[model samples]
Target: MKRFLAYIHRLIFILFLVSLNGCKEKKANILPEVSVSNKQKKQVVYQVFTRLFGNTNSNNKPWGTLEENGVGKFNDFTDKALKEIKDLGVTHVWYTGVPHHNVITDYTKYGISNDDPDVVKGRAGSPYAVKDYYNVNPDLAVNIENRLQEFKALVDRTHLAGLQVIIDIVPNHVARNYQSLTNPKGVEDFGASDDKSKVYDVNNNFYYNPKETFKVPVWEPDYSPLGKENHLLEDHEFDENPAKWTGNGSQLSQPHANDWYETVKINYGISPDGKKDFEELPAGFENENYKKHAEFWNDKTVPNSWKKFKDIALYWIAFGVDGFRYDMAEMVPVEFWSYMNSNIKMKNPDAFLMAEVYNPNLYRDYIKKGKIDYLYDKVQLYDTLKHVMQGYGKTDNIPPIQEGLKDIEHHMLHFLENHDEQRIASIEFAGSAEKGKPAMVVSATISTSPTMLYFGQELGESAEEDAGFGKPSRTSIFDYIGVPHLQRWVNDKQFDGGQSTENEKALRDFYKRLLNVTINSSALAGNYQDIHLFNRKNTKNYNDKILSFVRWSADEKLIVVSNFDADTNQKFQLKIPQDIVTSWQLKTGSYLVKDELYDTFSSQFVIKNGEGTIAISLKALESVILKIQKI
Candidate 1:
């Protein structure tokens, strides 16, 4: 009996041990291989301004047809450029301004509007000034569906080369001379005026003066605000006004009246009478003339133009884009986006929707309330770049940048540059192009956001001009050949031209390394829990220079230290917690070294108790990343 009892006890103990081992293994696997959904994974986005990037083998001048200007053909972009981008291993390609329009001519061809003087002297109008949201720019392709299919083929090729595709969607206004002005699809769906009562008012039917109307102004601002209404007047005032102006005046007419900005207003509402109704909530319409324009957002059933928005959304996805970048999200209704999001997910969940939201205050709300999948993190990009270019200063309050990373899985679409903002390099370099390249590269890469690169960013097109309304002005940096020109100059000169020549190569490599780390390391892909800030006290001395932090998951850990200072080297030590000390490897640049390994660094370095501190001999405005891992 005693022997039998002993045998039973031994069997029970063995079972208990096996169960414990299984649980441990499950936990380990869970932490190491969290399935990164389409939304969660890091994306390398390449922005393309369609007209600027095509093969242009056809006899199209800058101002010619979309086919001539480089829209439909996938092979228009340079092989070298594509090779470099493919080499960089970009995950997605976002083409801006591919949608077609007849009313909105490319800038280079527009009969120069004197009123909107900021319109580039030799311009191709921006894609944002949409003639029709559903159609591709005829200049870009023939039939809308065909154009999209051709574009999708490019995306497939991109995928063949290992990348995805995202396109732009303008949720706001349509082109100045859209065919729908008289007979809108949504209005037709809502049952247009059976009485055939079309009221023609100079103020409502046509473009208007800026002072009287709220239509987003196209004319050069007569007076510019300096901080707070400090005005900067234009050198020459435009004679042609859009309000009183008629189609007979020119192909693209401005409202002749000087009272308001002339652009077709969107009507989000309808009266029971089947007449148009618009809404500007806080400010009701005082003038009968402006009431028709007010018909844009007045329909209660629609809720801020949502009903019509659904059709537009359907049109694009049907056109075949994997994702969309929603323009000016804050101004639009949040419920509309939320509704659209649910519908889009129902139809195609993988579709990406990135919102243009500037304020950090709205980040959480947009995600929670608006159902926005991704938003640009301007503050993070700005502060980090400032630190790298200038040095640490009191201006660097990193709380927002830090707080932003907390729920980044849903809230963050990391970006250094996009269409609406200044070029990342321009911000870092400012007037001296020489100093900008290296600092911009290092700061942009190490910030560690799901990076978005605007068109021409890789080669070096500075965001130097004012992105005026409608015009593809100088402020925009979608110039495709700009980089090629730089490449040519560099090859011809055989010199970095007194700039940090390595900046470009370093940036390219940094991106490659960062992406490899993101795709390969389970640590970066998992939840960014256990975040700690360390050795950042001397912010004033370094001003914009030094930033260091630690991010870890159950399976891995990393200590990222960066020097934003352009002039001096930053040295800092970390008192790592004893629990996480022993199993760590040091990664410098792209190379990984075991803590036990010894080597000479041009700068100083040491590790103790698994706590490694670095004294970097940084070059002018360079960024260094120390990737620590536990075995």
Candidate 2:
């Protein structure tokens, strides 16, 4: 027994030495602000691809039409289905691809123009290339004429299920053919009244190239937009007498195939030289919230495109949308967001507004001046976690990331899977959904940020099948296909996971438990203290693969430890420092630390010397969010 104890002691000493050289060499020099008040539970958003969410068709043929593979309709989101989503702890549901985008479905009979096969990315079309602002996709309705009513019914049902609805607002661009056949009686379609002769004008909706005809991209052997329709649009050219700038800001008459070729860029009163020609945000508006910013714009005159989008957003808000997920928000302008988001908030004060922004430098400006509620943390949290999951990144980098964004952790939304990112279970990512458990635990609990989960993330859907327009890794956003795991959960509209395997069901259960805990935990939103460096410098057997942190509030406290290594169990002592124990006002006594995640493991800690020590052995890819109670 003495020899065994000696061996364990030597092992702990080795871990401490390696960590000291690796982690403590550069401890996080900064700390986040603390709120010693009562804690509020955080918000969680669930992103669902509207056209694919309820589709059970497994016939995933590449570039297939809606009839071939089938599409999920608005009616498919039954009350039971939505309740299942709400029960997963989602406060908001981002219904992607709800707007009317160009497609090859030939809705010409319903007065909707037939989109050219040359411009559409896939048979189902790209959602970002929105063709109509006032209409929902006709393909999503049982009767094409009643599409809007169907969508409205969805919104009403969503609210009835106690969930808010968030749809996409692509402000930076529109379809190459900007014709909204079903706009409100007084609403003019984009570019309908503009003078198309001018290249740049404040009133002009798009930048034009006079006398230049728009040419289609030369099709490659591997990719063809006109799949199985070789004879269709054999002319291979769109009849634009004066070609406009491409959606990606390419002024070329004919953009490369890689460009956002299906869409046209919206001119926000910015000249071709990138000079701002519009009214700037009033100085000191940075200190103001959405309500104040809305008041600022009440009497002010803005650019024409700004007014056009504001009206569009107002129309949606009136139509019962709770908020918007602005597509490529940074590409438009900060001032436009300030104007639009403030207006949206004015109508619905509690509306959720999130953006797909990646520039870290513009985060604060967008948050404060632009009136955005949440920004994607892809560059900082998601990217760092991705590298760490792949076994190349150091866990020490996480603290610095949180420190840098300490002031706005609440506004930063974290996620492991989204439509734009590779699936956590994909071979290109961690190769297994089990690998993301620790990452998900840390992501959902590390800070006060709102958490987001893409559909199928919980059930280990790896995007293994190539569903057209893109390769496997990310599920295709521009195709008629069904998600394998999500379809099983849908279970042909029962949504009871009747077809899920035991492993898949358990994976989903983990997500359900984790998310419910996150939305219910007061400590998650109250205070955050990184206890990693202390463990690395002082504790025995705590390595870089293990992360340690503490969250506390007036009534509740939690210590989170996650093991990132997937090969071996992490046996260590999670030591609570003297200052933290006193600061938390934890009384000196014995306590039971219960695992809130799985509720299967726990530890007994004896408090003394102004400190608390709990011995634990976390298994490979295991995590524990402990709830401490005096016993």
Candidate 3:
């Protein structure tokens, strides 16, 4: 009897040990709750056309000279100006047209060569046609000789004001006459050592039409170089022996009038027969991080063009520039990006690298393999939202896109108006600035992606000027012109909107509130679930014009709804599904719902039977962000 009792005791002790081990494994599998404040911060980019942002001149003449239009200087970005931008909740300032592009204005006195009028876009040339890779735009400086210093000062000032700086890097092409007077030691020009006798060489920087001499494009009847201004270099002739391929991949000796004739394409060792001359990335390289990618290229030899671009990017990174916006990135090879962007990350891991990749099919490849941080979400989100805004499409179309891009949603950058797109207030677009409010809300808060706001977008700047070489509807990036609405907000260097109209002021206030809320909202950086489909099926009087979604974190919960109806006021019951209610762990009770954007209104979110519902009314072109909290 004593032996049997001892055996039972031993068996019970082993069972206790087993249960303890099971508890340990269970605890190990549980994920720790992260606070909302601890989540990643969403980026808000404010893209400003540097030359036009602070220009107070309202004299927007067609093809106006620099002296006539009065360009904005680096000194124009005053402390007050930067503070106002920061107050608008902008994380980074993209200073477009900062590079030394080919311009009609002669800097020959400063040893800069004169750009032929036929090759330049306007008095202030297209920023994409970069003339000098190693210098800043001479026109943007108060003192031309000290332009680089002025830019450095502006960068430092911007940093002092707690904002990062971003600039353009036109990698796929260079100005028709590419020169780099300020290149650092031992650095050579792009095509200095290229064997011009050959049409395609692995080491050549540019692809040449060996026997074909370059000829200028046939001018259209209405358009001429510099708008037919009687400039000294407007002879309608450009000399290029062994003419290179046009920027848009036109193989003709003289490209079409509509082609990117002002710039020449850079060759990346890809043969004319569509075969790669350089080493290809091994399979499964797409899953590797930038560090591993960088290491892979450490001992490898790349094409000459790749090295030149990489050097230029690193030079800018060393010069205190925080990021780059690559123009026409998809035009270049993805392998080049993998090399360039990986090197950039190795230098500054936090560098904001965004590109203009319009092809949705190549989005993931560019992002994961190329190490690119963001691509313009123009074709999908922007087009759909624009259609909804124009009254031709329904909000129902948005959910499928969001669902489709769930894997790479954060890599997609959202914008309503850019330098390339028409203004929201333009007649060709929505015809009223108020129409952008709902779209703006949806664009900013729909995903965890970075939100970009054009400089004059807040103040309802209708691109109404017929600037030289630039027509109405889209703001002129190719000419020296002042933005009227932006100038009003400038208020003569005060950087205060004293000269703005009442409507403009209210519109700006709307943007201000929306942006500030976006950057600080932890819920926006967390998980997103679409309630639009559920609300459409369950709620009363909820139409396709009204869009709804839910976003939440460990601490905060948000229900965002926007009304696209320009003429109708909407009052409806917005419902949250039972699954989401259960996920949120909210018991049956009335919770206080407050609008984070506008504080004047508040509503109650009642949760009953594992479902949440709220009654809300939104006016025409209006939106609301309802925050739920336990009362």
Candidate 4:
């Protein structure tokens, strides 16, 4: 009886051990619940000119036609290409030139109207001058009749590859010949129901000059439409009986040659006399959240333009577009943005809304009141960085701009190059792609804001081709030309760097490493302190040409330093402020300091008497991200 009782006890103990192991295994497989704020990854936007991204054509003729300088189709962004893009550490892909614009190509067979060369910016046309709001560009489709479906498929592929899609929403203007053929049943076109006799009305979609006739702008001495190509409609006359206000707010019947002649301004109930026809938001509406602000506009009697834009935005959102890049957002009123963006959030709470608003005074108003996700950090950070890259500005200018916008720093998106800016590798900008390396490091790591990269910027594209309507030093958004550096990386549809030069390959590899670190590091999204100012005052050999800063979170700490000097190799003892040392809770000892970007270098970080210091040796236009942990 005693032996049987002992055996039962041993069996019970073994069962208990098995049950405990099972619980342990279950707990190991379940991920811990992370807070929403802690799960936020730094966004990296890859903005590609859609038509130029896949064109393998090496023939880049000036004023080239679609057949001569081949255009990339929606089918060009194959699964392999998108996967390569995703591998570059991109979260969002801004596909520019996706909407239907007034291209000077004949597509009458597909029920699309031909655009006069006189009214188009180039043979391909300006993407900002949207011609049809309801259709995709026919020039970008494998089959002209299936353009919209092809775009939709591209959107699906982007989503499947774990990236979001962003396209343009030019709210301030439309093509001079604006027309929409596929409006959803009951919607009327702009100006279709307007009373053209009045200069401004509450419901008019445009501002008019009553009985004045419209005339095309005078051509420059050496330039003409399509490089003086003879066309049937190139008679230098358009058929508008009454002139409307030019896109740049010129009230004259004939705008200047530099004006936005291919487009017309969209009126959002703001009259020529500066009186608003729509009801303004209540004074305290700026302090409200999007849901509350949306409720405020639900019952308000808004203008026809407001409803039209709201419908247009919601349509895209429903069509699986992740967000919009609003062109010239500041040109529109803040109240209109509040109304438009609020409705957008109601449809998709995660829709990313970035805009181009260069005025610093209006940044907060656009962000807090307008509910814009991001505004171009151009006038402040970008301009400062440009001057520094050109060898005139100091690193000290960066901290003040950062301090000024500290309250809303996350909403300021940073970039070294974009479609509107000069390429970093261009002779007019930095003169060499290697010169941009340190600047890009600082731009990507200096803030918790998102970073944007132009398509060929990674491969050191100089934009040296003077493609007809577009000049040198800037990639042509107006012309259908293949980018040389980008095509090499495309490598004849293999989507590999097979044809890239060794220097170009090295540059791209550096970009891949930097961007991956930017997205994965938690310290980058945390607290920041500028050690550049402190080091400049304390450390010997530390000059204004080098910038250093510290970023830290609970789990990680980083010291980022960059030498912007193009001719001198810098060696200095970079110091961290005593306050930061205390904040990081470092005891007087040595810590392991290793470079997170490149593994070729090693150093030691020592703490003594509540101060931290590290030896830094950086070559010209070189940067290092040293991560430290207790030894």
* lDDT to native, each model: 0.44, 0.85, 0.87, 0.86
Query: Model 4: per-residue lDDT, tens digit, 246-328?
Result: 77667878888778888888899898878988778778877899999899889999888888889999989999999999998
Model 1: which ten-residue window has the lowest total lDDT? 24-33
Candidate 2 worst ten-residue window by lDDT:
1-10
For lDDT, the strongest prediction is 3
lDDT of 1 at 431: 34
Residue 102 CA error for candidate 2 (Å)? 1.0
Give the TM-score of each candidate. Answer: 0.64, 0.94, 0.94, 0.94
TM-score of 4: 0.94
Q: Give a tens-digit lDDT track for model 1, residues 1-631.
A: 2123334443543343344433312211111224444344455677766654543232323333223333323444434455556555467778777664332233333231122322211234446555545545544553333654666566666656566667776655444444332223444321122111222321132323433322223444453211122112222233333322222122123332322122244433333244434322233322222223223233433443455566667665765667788766764555455556656655566777787765555666666655567887554444345344443332234433444345554356665445664444465334333344444333333333456666545545454433222223223322222233233323422323223256555554555554445544444454332112323332223333444444444455544444444456644443333233332344323223222111223333355544445444444544444444332
| Poorest stretch of ten by lDDT in candidate 4 | 24-33
Off by over 4 Å in 3: 1-39
* Residue 6 of model 3, lDDT score: 30
Steric overlap count per candidate: 62, 0, 1, 0
